[model samples]
Target: MKEVLVGSACAIALALLAGCSAEQPAGPAPATRPLDPTAADLVARAGSYYADEQVLQDAEATLVHRCMTTRGFRRPPPAPAAPVSHDEEWRPDPAHRRTDGYGLARAGRGEPPDPYFVALAPAHQERYQRELVGDMARRATLDLPSGPQLSYPTTGCLAESRAQLYGDVMEATRVTSVTQDLHNTVYLAAQADPEYRRTLARWADCMKRRGHPYGSPQQARNALAAERRSAAPTAAQRHEVAVAVADAECAAEVALPGTFESLLRRHAELLPEAQRAELNRLATSRAAALRHARQVAQR
Candidate 1:
């Protein structure tokens, strides 16, 4: 468990697939069938351990602002709330498909530059970074479950803010990575299971009937992702909506969401004892951090 000391001094912060060529009509929203009581209970239990990222980011920015202002730097504007996550499901949720589709174009457009920071001289900017984040030469690192290592400043205002909110900053970070790992593990497992493969085949058949010819939802999303970069933004978004509508309809036709949830529940039950203990401990830490974050954000 390496403590991640690396963070942005300014404040450490924090996908659709597929292209349809023509803009198809987005009719009534597809129905996402309600999960059974057992599945719903599991989802609720798992969800409780996680804090809202946007709220947490808001809290962090607030803490960083207060810390920097006390130290005499002009305050940076509040960072925008984190965008909705695409990986919330294997496919886009109903609202996401209807609204943003893949929403790739919208990325990198919303973050406002820090005017106060921008006005500083080059020498001053370097000093600001050091003061805001801590020593750039020294780093703290955490290895993600997905094989990538994340590094950040551990000694700056960002670190102090994180420590204030989360008792053990590294453990707090680990909670997120661990849960992400769990989701990836379970999702891949779901894809491997016979029942899920059958559902996917049915979904593929549905997509074929609709003229998408995609083998999996991910494949469609991938194709769209590639196409979006070349096409006009408006055209790409419209195509996304059209494809997303078809994707949702096909997913409903096979009850893919429910099937995935069922597999997730089953996989969670089978996790190793050590991993489960880790989750329980991390969840407790996250719950406490979330409480403090809410208080900070409110102030």
Candidate 2:
């Protein structure tokens, strides 16, 4: 699959895992930390600016199909309709862990091949690739603050799809990307906070009690990765599910999500006013884009 313009909430879960761990062993902190109103408002504001990644994926698929078929190519199979959630601000929860189990099974179920593309002649395949994503030699780039530079094509079905939804593909890409960078920034700041560390230690202890000996969620995930390599496929899957379930349970026991949210709020206040304004402007554009995307998706 071609990479999307923005990241999903789950994409940030890796950083969340690291932020939720501790260096020093300690008991869980008090579970009653008062929520910060300012931070809550900031998150609420940020969430308003974005849709779930699945929604964008499905919509773009619709647009891409239209663009391709107009150029006389065979229409690809329609993308399945995604369950839409406009203001989804993802936080780690045990239910997701129980169901996805670190997403190994989902990862294993690789993307299906496109029959139309597969049957194409080599020359036609080259045309298809160019039509889908444009020239690889010439690309547009965006240099994000405190993040790596991002580049993509300025033409083709991919570009057309993005333009249809975001109005200005390059600018929208830069604008929407800020939320992810902000999330990364907050997570890094949270890692150094003593309160967050203490809560993580409690979570570690909780996991240890449940028969998973791990100092951090990242460590447990690493161990699972190695286990997948060494153990039988079935056995590895079973082990992964067991450890993931225990990890979620321990996270709950230690009030990990609540603590992390508190830390997010505390650290989020440090963001510059200019960045916040950018987010607000992006939200306006996103809302307008989603309206168009919804209509296209329905067709």
Candidate 3:
């Protein structure tokens, strides 16, 4: 079966693990804590902007489908809708937090193949793929401030749609890239903090008492992945649900999520001056993009 374990949240969890170690350090400084209201508001606004961007992307996809139809190619209808909150990265729903342990198992469930595309001739299928994403070799790379390069198609309906929506694809990519990097830095710092490690230990013990002996939520998720490797989709999902519930219960019992959120806030405050400046820029750019997305939606 295809690996479905590792959605956006799981990806973040994996990134966090990079900073974790066997030895715990001193507790976080009281003065450097993450419970600031202003910072929370900023993060909330940033998250809202990301949601707006998704709306714009969905609009662009629709435009691409229309363009493809105009070009005499058969376009499939959009895939069935799933729960939107399920895909959101950072925001954890308290009521459902324990249901998808880090969202890894949930991420692993592959989207069903589109029947329309499947019925198409192989040549048509190839054309559709090419037209949708374009040739990688022909794409342009945008160097991000976060020390990463993003490769995007310079030509194709997808590219055209993006250009129309954002006016400048590179600028859009730069803002989003920097924002992501800033967010990642916080996660890394949180994982490294001694307080976070202590909370994680408590969560681990809670999981252990529940018959899930895992070092961390990420570790538990990995075990689930290996365990479900040969299971049918339904069976795998059942297992994931059970594990996620337990994970959530453990997290709540230990107040890990609240502690983690506070740690992230504290770490975010400790970012280098240059990164903080970039985050401000991202906020400004995102605000502008939100306006543009609204305009696009209206049209």
Q: Estimate each model's TM-score.
A: 0.74, 0.75, 0.69
What are the runs in model 3 whose C-alpha is more than 4 Å off? Answer: 1-54, 74-81, 86-109, 135-137, 229-240
Q: Give the candidates in order of lDDT, highest first.
A: 1, 2, 3
lDDT scores in order: 0.70, 0.70, 0.65
Poorest stretch of ten by lDDT in candidate 1? 11-20
lDDT (C-alpha) at residue 131 in model 3: 77
Q: Which stretches of candidate 1 lie over 4 Å from their true place?
A: 1-51, 76-83, 86-91, 107-116, 143-149, 229-233
Candidate 3 lDDT by residue in tens digits, 5-95? 6566546666877543445688966553332343333443333544555675666666677777876676674442343462222233545
Error of 1 at 227 (Å): 3.0
Of 1 and 3, the candidate ahead on lDDT is 1
> On residues 18-56, what C-alpha lDDT tens digit does candidate 1 reach at each position?
322445789997553333433323233334322366667
State the weakest 10-residue window (summed lDDT) of model 2: 83-92
Highest TM-score scorer: 2
Of the candidates numbered 1 and 3, which has the greater TM-score value? 1
Candidate 3: 10-residue stretch with minimal lDDT: 81-90
The number of residue pairs in model 1 that clash at the backbone is 15
The digit string of per-residue lDDT tens for model 2 on 1-299 reads 99865755555654676443335678896454332443333343334333445566778888898889877787656857554422111244456565556766656667778788889899988999999998788778876667688887888888878988988777557546765676677777876789988988898889888899898877887888888888998888888878888887777778877777677767766666666555556555666777777887677
